[model samples]
Target: MTAADLPEIKILIDATELFPSSMLGEMVQQFLSGNEAKEIWLVLTNPQSVGVAYVAPEKLTDGTFNLLLIAVHPKQQGKGSGTQLIAEVENRLKELGARILLVETSGLEGFELTRRFYLKNGYELEGRIRDFYQDGDDKVIFRKVLT
Candidate 1:
């Protein structure tokens, strides 16, 4: 995605409860500026973007990549769009010599589906940080090793 895609990408991000709208601009800027570790991918259906995935390769690590942010439009949530986008990200990361891909999500009731999605997609539970996000919301990390 290009700079012109930021607004739509922000909309997709906003539709989900994962991130705050205020940080969208800064995040987009960071991706656009060619940060060595960061990469953003957009899923477009026609002229409108329906999904976004923000990923980063771990610096000074042995082929590790992080799936930083991923969101699909609310209207398209259960229709395989998210899986397709994730598959694309994994393919690209593998091409870049990534051996392990990690993803983290909130450990709250609201995020159960998100966690399940990762598990369903072949990711294994790696670890969790207690009260990482707040007093109750923990951070659950998942890892997938590329063959």
Candidate 2:
């Protein structure tokens, strides 16, 4: 996505309850400015964005990338938008010779569906960090190997 789409993307982020980022605009701008470390992908329904995926290559690692965030607007959830976004991201990464795509998500009760989404998309549960996010909330990690 380009800088012009930042506003709509931010709205998707907000609506999805993803972690708020005060620097999203600047971050996207830097990516547009040749920050190869970051890439933002969007799924739009004509004028409005319905899904987004923000990813970054893992530093000092060959063919390793992290899916920092992926979300589908509530209204767009339950549709194939998310799976399509995942397929797009994976296809693009495979073209880049990426071997592994990692995703991290909260392990809270509220995030059960989110975790399941990743699993359903061919990402295997790799590990989990106890009390990583807080006293009780954990950080669950999943991995998808792309040949």
Best by TM-score: 2
Off by over 4 Å in 2: 37-40
Candidate 1 regions with alpha-carbon error over 4 angstroms: 35-38
**15-35: candidate 1 lDDT, tens digit per residue:** 886678678778767667777
Write one digit per residue (lDDT tens) for candidate 2, span 1-147: 777777788888788777675557765676778756446455555458888887789989998999987888898898889898989999889988899999998899999999989989999999999999999999999999999
lDDT against the true structure, each candidate: 0.84, 0.84
lDDT of 2 at 116: 88
For every candidate in turn, the CA RMSD to the true structure comes to 1.8, 1.6
Whole-model lDDT for model 1 versus the true structure?
Answer: 0.84
List of clashing residue pairs for candidate 1? none
